[model samples]
Target chain A: MIFLKFLLYVWMVLVLLGAFFYAPLAKGLGEYTRVMYFHVPMAWITTLTFLIGAIYSILYLRKKDIRYDYYSETANQLGLLFALLATITGSIWAKMSWGAFWNWDPRETSIFILLLIYAAYFALRSAIEQQDRKAALSAVYDILAFVTVPFFIFIVPRIYSSLHPDPLINTQGKVTMNGKMQLVFFNSLLAFTMVYFWMLKNKLEVIKLKMKLKQLES
Target chain B: MIKAYYIFRKDLLQEFKTRFAMNAILLFAVVTLSAVSFAIGTFTARQEVLSALLWIILFFSSMSGLSHIFVKEEEAKTADTLKLVASASAIFLGKFLFNIVLLFLLEIIVVPLFIALMNFNVQNYLLLFFTLFIGSFGLAGGGTMVAAIISKSGAKGALFTVLSFPILLPVLVSGISATKIASQEQGWMTAYSELQTLFAFSVVIITASILLFDFVWNE
Candidate 1:
């Protein structure tokens, strides 16, 4: 954990330097393209956490284990946080590039619905009082929400052209990356993923400790 | 399969007697459609706006009562008997079929009234009919499973809508787009892709729900 923290800090400084100094400013975005470093990673982390949560949910249903339930619910909460940040940062980026805070662009709509999905997940969880029933219902919901992710993020935006060009990818499926830009983008991706793991580890520990405390009290 | 039919028939009989889902949905539809006509009265709305408005009414009206398929069973304490007597998939089919019927009845009433009230023109009657037909099927399919999932929860009504909005957006988007094409007198080929999306949406959700229903329904 300590190593992971140190690595994250080092990667953070590198990302700051790489984004401003090392990465080349493109034609259209100029300085605003730097926001891609933060926004893109947040989006990636958001999708990744959601996938993790759904996988754990599926495992929970199959195994009938409460451990997997904890994993699923925690990951979902984390995914919601990441998705919120992604939306806000993406909104800032959109304001810079497209002259609006929220254009309901495909990506914006994508994140919005994603937020709704996770929000609904929590709502369903809260509404159910029984332990087993809550786990089972949330597991089913997690799987269903994950199923819609591809349709929202990939298919919907491509259908409409109101999407101003994405930073790393164009609508045409071509990678528009130069050498330096590619390096920084990939590094940010790696750094955010490590940060995700470190946070997941801490969250799992916290939940585990809480359960222990409840058991002792009982 | 026969057991599922029996379940569906049972629901039909009860609903025929009570008409709870049907009455609620149709009444909601009438009131909302009236309000919409009043709001947009005497103004020429775009084909897309009109199409979206029509769908908005249908969507909310459907939501108002779609959970009856499962909720009624739980409400009256029949869900336990259902668990013992019928297979999980049978229950899903029974609920799914009931929802489709309710939606069908709703459109049959609202469509004519909407066209009459709002001066909503449709150049392609067949395409408009097809869009409503398939869109509601998709709605019923997803809504049935979702209805089942939420039936066991305490806050049935609120959870149902919140959970359903994300899953059903693709259907609404494509449905609205297809209706727009049909309403604007665009070529049938123009709405073809949206129709394809709707078809795919229906197929995928129905299959997934059916496959997943046992896991959800069985406890």
Candidate 2:
């Protein structure tokens, strides 16, 4: 585990260096396009964590095991954290590119909706006092919230003409990035995904330790 | 299905006698509509703005009362008794139907009042009707399930709207867009995508709710 952590630390440093130095300037975006290396992967991680959260929620419901509930809750909280980071980073990028902090771009609107959905998840969790009920209700909510994600992320954006740049894989199903930039972008994505799993693993371990401590105290 | 029908009829009969949800929904719609029309008097807002405003009112009004479908049961301690009598899926369907009927009755009043007061003109009434019809199904589908989840919580009143808004946004987004097209005198083809989205959203939410209701209901 220590070796894995060391390797990830080195990997992320390399990815960061690649983002700043190795990636070439794009046609119009110039230096601002480098934001893609961080922002896009964060958004990607946000989606990944939420999907994982929903899957664990299903597992929790099926098995009625508290461990899956802990996993689901941890995943959702991380998802929310990453989503906020993505929104903040995207907003900063928007101010640079679109001359305004927010244009209500379809992407912005969808992310805002996503933020609200998960915020409501926490609200629901807080309102329920019983532990089992909180776990069950929140698990159900996590699944329901995820069901709407495809519509928000894919369909709603398609409905509106977006001011955001074309997705890395555009509608015609092509990778717009050149060879070198593609390498850095994929590397950044891989690095960030690794970071997400590391964070998840650490968070789960912390939760497990907390539960064990509580049992000892009781 | 027959068990579901009985549950629906029971809720409808109780609703007719008390008119609690109906009155809350209707009053909220009327007040919001009047405030909006008064605020924008002679403003002649664009069709898009008017269409969006109409949905905003419907969305808030639905939020005002939809949760009562389940909250009332929990408050009265009837939820457990109902669970014993009818299966979870049946209970979900019955409440879902109740909410749908209430929303339809709400539109019957609010839609006309909204158009008259806001000077909203819809050249394609059929498209407008279809949008609201399908949109209400989506609203009720998502709203009923959320209502079930929230009713079990301690903070039912405030949590209902907070929980339902995001889930209901897809319906609102498509509803507003389709209403805009209908008001602009566009044909059915122009609004087809939005209609399809509303239909799909309703189907997906209801199916998921049915599958998941057992967990919420039994526990």
Candidate 3:
């Protein structure tokens, strides 16, 4: 426990330091660049959480495990929260750069749709009273919906030109960032991933406890 | 295959016996089109405007048809019985085909009334027909799956649109685009890719929903 706390503190410190330098570092590029440090990391974290949720969903379907279902739910809830943050940050950045809060650009539209799909996921879960059915149906939808994520996020957007910038971090490594920018970006990514795991662990524990209490009552 | 056909026939027969579903859909379509026509003054006066107006009518009218898809089953408590005997795939196919038929009938009435009321000439009748057909298939296919999920929620009508519209964005985009292009009598190649995209979307969504239906319905 002590070691975990130490690690979390270290992670938080790194995140704060990265954020502190974001403006000065992004200044070398342009005024609008500050958004990338926060927006990109948040978007990455959200997508990572969504992927985790999709995996848990598949596991729940295969094993019929309630714990997996809870884990999936927790990830989905957190994913939605972060996705909203990503959208807001991106929108703010867009307004600064393009003088528009909303545009029908493919990326913007796709992310909005992605958010709505997950919203409907929760809605579908709530409408069903039976716990097992809710788990099963949500699992199926999650898997199916995730399959479309690539199409919406990648394929469709690339098909049409858009104002949104491509990723600085590519498969091969940093795209064109200088050494300093790379260091800060990498640190931010690591810190955010740690934060995501920490939150997920706590959220799953709470979910387990709630389910236990519910079971006891019945 | 034969069993699937039997299920389809059974649904149609049952619907006809009561005439409730068909009557509700047809009346709603006619009344809504008439109201819109009256509001627009005359159809021919604004050809481009009429084209868009026609799609809006079809979209909203389809919503009413989709909302009650499973309401009667739940009320009558026949859903469980149906589930026990009929394959999930069969049920989905039957319901999907039924929706297509109902939507087709509604469109037949609505489309003509739209042209006549709006006084818009369909330059390429065949292209217009094709776009409408493909667009309807995409809508019905997607709407049927969502309706099944929503039906289990016990929240019908407007709730259906709330749950469905997001998933239906791509369909809406392609539908409107195709309608616009076809109304202008654009060449098939010009809109062919968009049409194919819509068709592919229908296939993918239907297949995914069918595979996932057992998980949803059994629960």
Candidate 4:
């Protein structure tokens, strides 16, 4: 685990360096293209974490396991964090490229909706006082929220011609990135996903420890 | 399904008797419509803005009272009785249908008043009707399920809108776009994709709600 953590550290550092120095800047975008390496991966991790969160929520519902609730809750909170990062990073990039922090672009609107959906998740969790009831209701909510995600991320954004950059895999069915960019980009995705899972694992451990301490006190 | 219908009828009968949900939503719709038309008097707002305004009125009006289908059951302590009598899915379906009827009633009154008051011109009545109809299904589907979820929580009123808004956004977006097209175009083909989106959204939301209702209803 320690070795894996060390590797993650090196991998992220190398990806950052490659994003700046190794990857060739693209036409028109120049230095701003580097934001894609971090921003895109953060967005990818946001979706990935939310997907995992929903999956575990289904598991919790089926198995009636408190541990699964912990997993689902932790994954969801991390997903929200990464989503916030993705939005802030994308906003900075937007300000640079579009001359404003927000343009109400299709992509921006969808992510903002995702933020609201998960924020509602937390609000729902906070409102329910009982443990089991909170877990059950929230798991159901997570699943319902996940069902709408595809519409927001995939469908709604595509319904309008967007100010956001063409996706990595554009409508023309082309991978826009060249070789070194792809290498760095994929590595960044891998690094961030690894970091998310690592954080999820540690957070779950802390949750378990806290539960144990609560049980002892009781 | 029969039980579901019975549940729907029971709620509808109660609704007609008390008229709580109907009155709340109708009052909201009328007030909002009058305020909007009074504000934009004789301005001849653009088709796009008018279409968006219609949906905004419908959305907020539904938000005012749609959650009552579940919140009422919980508050009156009839939720437990309903649970004993009906399966979770049946209860959900019944409430879903009741909410749909309530939404339609709100639309019947508001849409006409909105048009008359704002002088809104809808070129394709069929397209506009289909958009509003399917959009109401989406709203009630999402609204019923969310109301069930939040009815279990301590804060019901505020949480219902917060929870349902994001879920219902696709419906609103597609509905507004379709209404915009309906205002300018003469055929359904022009707004084909928007109608398809509204249809798909309603199907997805309702199906997911039914499948997940067991958890929220029982627990």
Best by TM-score: 2
Instruction: Show model 2 residue runs off by greater than 4 Å.
Output: none
Query: How does the DockQ of candidate 2 come out?
Result: 0.83
lDDT for each of the candidates?
0.87, 0.92, 0.78, 0.90
lDDT of 3 by residue, B64-165 (tens): 777566777777889999888788888888888888888999888888877776776776778788878887887887788777777676556656776667
lDDT of 2: 0.92
Q: Which candidate is the best by lDDT?
A: 2
Better of 1 and 2 by DockQ: 2
Tell me the TM-score of chain B in each candidate. Answer: 0.97, 0.98, 0.92, 0.98
Please give the DockQ score of every candidate, comma-separated: 0.72, 0.83, 0.43, 0.83
Q: Predictions ranked by TM-score, top down? A: 2, 4, 1, 3
| Per-residue lDDT of model 2, residues B1-219, tens digit only | 999999999999999999999999999999999899988988789999999999999999999999999999989999888988988999999999999999999999999999998899999998999999999999999999999999888898898889989988999999999999999975788788888889999989999999999999999
lDDT of 4 by residue, B1-219 (tens): 999999999988998899999899999989999899889987789888999999999999999998888888889998888889989998889889889988998899999988888888989898888889999999999988988898888898888888989989999999999999999989878688788889998999999999999998988
Instruction: Give the per-residue lDDT digits (tens) of candidate 1, residues A1-218.
Output: 67867878998899878988899977565688788888888888888899999999889888998889999899999999999998888888788878999978877887899899888889889889999999998899888878877788877776765565564445477667788888998998888888888899999999889888998999
Error of 1 at B2 (Å): 1.9
Scored against the true structure, residue B185 in model 1 reaches a CA lDDT of 85
Give candidate 3's iRMS in Å, 1 decimal: 2.2
Which parts of model 3 are misplaced by more than 4 Å? A19-29, A167-174, A211-218, B42-52, B119-124
Residues A8-67, candidate 4, lDDT per residue (tens digit)?
999989988998899998867758768888898889889999999999999999999888
